[model samples]
Target: MVTERLPAKISEKSEEKKIAPASPIGIFDSGVGGLTVLAEIMRQLPNEDVIYIADSARVPYGGRPPEEIIKINQELIPYLIDQGVKLIIMACGTSSSIAYPVLKDKYKVHIIGLIEPGVRAALSATRSGTIGVIATAGTIHSQAYQKTLQSMKKTGLPAGREIKIAAEACPLFVPLIEGGFIETEETRKVAKEYLKPLLKEEIDTLILGCTHYPHLVKVLNALTGGKVVLVDPAEEAVAEAKGLLQKAGTMKGKTFPPRYEYLVTGSVAQFQDVGSRLLGKLITHARQARLPTPERSDGGQVHLPLK
Candidate 1:
């Protein structure tokens, strides 16, 4: 169930307020793709409130310049923090690859990106020490997953066995998924061409590197014929979040129904329609939100409005 309401005014002296256990977990993405992550979070951490921000106005961050991605995140991250979220999840592969490393340490709230979790999961699932990753061009260009896998391969797998990694950039997947073309023959055709190289490499494990790629699981599975293990990084990322919250003693109590707030920087009607279809539940309402202007104050902080 979803409902629309005005956001409460957040105090300017936000730093003074402690992020309590009951504070909402914030998740943001380039667009509706992040709903994949949100689904895992809901299944695993049902009692916690969630504030999801979809930067659909700038959807498809895949091919953007690195500087532009960072700038866009500079606006979105602080806006989420201002909403009083206790933690933030970088649910977009492009952002996770390009912006996360640059911005993670600068923020006060804990930020979890999809790369590390994905690399770890792929390593765990690869019995043959051969893995393939498919994501957006920006993510592939950044070489985030490839580098991480290379670095961790020695320790993650048996000593003598080497890890073979094949990475591909499937830029069309996002547009197809966002356009609500999940199971179409065109999607299957595109996916088949994309997976051909990885299949030729005989990879035993495949990482659905983009959050948007999970929606194409049916096509993916059919293409692989149940021979390859598929890893959805959202599962590991949410599990890591659960572990961190538990260790920090900040898991929300099961005393009440969890609140789910949806905000977008684009069309509410479109987001609701596609999001509902992807999530298999009606997104009855989603409030439209704007990012704080890029101008920074003397202390180098983005000035967010109280409302």
Candidate 2:
């Protein structure tokens, strides 16, 4: 059996060296989309603290330029780091694509993105050679999924085989989810139209490349007729985070599920309303936060408003 080596510069660490038990695992997305990843991480790594930030003020980074996305990420990420987070999870697919290479090597803590894990899950689940990916406009336009799939094909994994990758941008997905329309007929119609190509292509597996898409899981499932497998990238991302934390010995003994902290850059009430719909649970409060200005080249900073 061949063993895959951990990426260079990442290694085992002693858990006792940590300064505080309350250190959080910082997660950020363009808006409430990240809650999907937060849900999975809370489920899988029950003992850690999660600090989730929703940049609702600048929601839907899709269709924006990569440089703009990078600026947003640079600002959001550094703020999370300043909050003393042990690890940073880039839950936004667009930001992950634009900033991961530039930011990952610079951060002292571990950085995990949604793309590679999503690709891995898609590759693993596909019995047929073709895979379908549905994401935001920015993510699809970035071609991150295609690039990852191509890299996976080149890497020669065990039982190596080439896989065909297809991607589509579902621009309406986030709006539908945030508008509390996931269960509505309108959402179903959109899902059907957006998914038609993949269905026609006879793709056996589909990657739900956008974090917000998971909130519409049932709608998508219904449209796909339970035949095509849908892969939630956030779920796979959390699994990867658990593995990394475990291997690094950062996992504390399981006592109880981690407490979740939600922060939003825009309306708190909207976050609660939309977050409750996405999370399938009521969110009483979302602490206010100020994201950095994109103009700042130093990766703008974030400030939490006094409660």
Candidate 3:
């Protein structure tokens, strides 16, 4: 699961001291939902440049087939690579669950996903040895959380104790959050319904599996009575990335603050609007970029046209 921060094939000249290793870290999400992850990375790694691409044109990957999401990422990733990103963050839960392994093995650059960090944090936060995961339908269907917890339990849990993992798919949460209904009472009602199962389980820790789920933290927290701890993967993921980059000697934070660049497949205005809401501040220039289309003639390969 470990990936190099940069490709060895990258010109040694590019690795020289004349250029800092602080190139942009690329992040991709199915849609505006990923801005939450992007914001976390910005807050945690202020010295590193960031590039976020929102695939709003095909927003919800949650219900898409794994192969389809893989196809989407195969096209999306190389564009980011060409942007000179030092690392790639699969901010979308669907992509992380299904596509990350293939991309991580194929790409020489470091690739991090959102799911594992959340799972790890949930495991750590749970004193009752029971963890609840709430995610998009696709993520839940993928059984990523279930599989992860099972593997960890087999290897890491004490011989007598079992780690119980409960997962629910809150499909409505994504649309509600992305549609700017985060603060509505409707959202509260929906959150209560969706979270009641976990509340009954009395699980001590909950993982906000979808990047969009964090947007409803207030509603979710109220439903849990502030007792159950909520784990935001974005936070954990950035922390992991910080440690990884530092250990790799690839971070440059002793000088100026890191710059950030944002790219989106949808209109710049739309991304800016949602991004600002997610970041809780103004989002500066975000250049518009189109996602590549698949060319069947090329064996389901993505063909990028001139930007």
Candidate 4:
């Protein structure tokens, strides 16, 4: 058996001390998409304080360059850490695929992303070795899903079952959903078109690679004819997050209302409105903020207003 060695820095943290039990959990997505994950986290860990950031100004990271996605994550994670969060969740699929590897090494606190958990869930649910992944273009192009599944197969488990992956980049799905088209005929049509190939490949499990993608769960479930197990990363990821909080002694022992904070580099009112509708919470406030200007040389910061 081969054992993977932890980096010296990570070992130092565990050896030195665990995160403060009461510290808030920080979570960020390119935009409102992460609220899906946030909703799940809240459901499972209601008493834990949470600070969520929606980088709505830079919404829809599906087709962005890898460097741009990582740069944005670089800004978001550090800001969350500066707010004294004990843990961070990369709630965007594109960021999970492209940015997590680069940013995880730079941070001291535990950073969790959607990919590995999504991969594990897909693996566990699949009776046949074929898996279907539907995510953003950036995520699919990064090949994160395929790589993780194949790596697991190499671990010599499941003896004769070989994992095969079929990934599709559904670039327009996010826009469709964010535009309030979920459960609409337009959404159904687009989703069916996006899912056709995977169904054709006889996938027994479909991984909803994007956090935003889960908002279309009913649409996807119906389209897949209820024959396929829909593996949602948020569900699996939050389960692991619960264990981590417990290990760090951060799991709330008694039920108490915990503070929930929201921030965004976009329209505050808009984020609050849409956030409230999607998250099942009255999001009364969202602070307008800025990421360091993307073009450092020019200092031309992009401030996008959420629609």
Best by TM-score: 1
lDDT by residue (14-76, candidate 2, tens digit) is: 122342445779999878888888888767877898888888766777866777677667666
Q: Give each prediction's root-mean-square deviation over alpha carbons.
A: 5.6, 8.7, 6.4, 7.9
Off by over 4 Å in 3: 1-20, 154-159, 293-307
Error of 3 at 242 (Å): 1.2
The TM-score values for the models, in the order shown, are: 0.90, 0.85, 0.86, 0.87
Best by lDDT: 1
Alpha carbon RMSD to native, model 3: 6.4
CA lDDT of each prediction against the hidden true structure: 0.86, 0.76, 0.75, 0.79
After superposition of all CA atoms, the RMSD between model 2 and the true structure is 8.7
Candidate 4: regions farther than 4 A off: 1-19, 154-157, 294-307
The C-alpha stretches of model 1 lying farther than 4 A from their native spots are 1-16, 291-307
What ranges in model 2 sit over 4 Å off?
A: 1-21, 154-160, 254-257, 292-307
lDDT digits (tens) for residues 37-87 of candidate 1: 999998999899999988776668888778878877776777678778889
Report residue 243 deviation for candidate 3 (angstroms).
Answer: 1.8
Against the true structure, candidate 2 reaches a TM-score of 0.85
Window of ten residues with lowest summed lDDT in model 3: 1-10
lDDT of 3 by residue, 1-307 (tens): 1111212133312332222466778898866778777778767887788777777656677876777788777766766776777778898888888888667777766789987788777777778888899987888998888898877664445677788778899888876776778889999999889888887887888988888888888888888889999988989888888887888777767477766666665557867887788778787687766443423323332233322
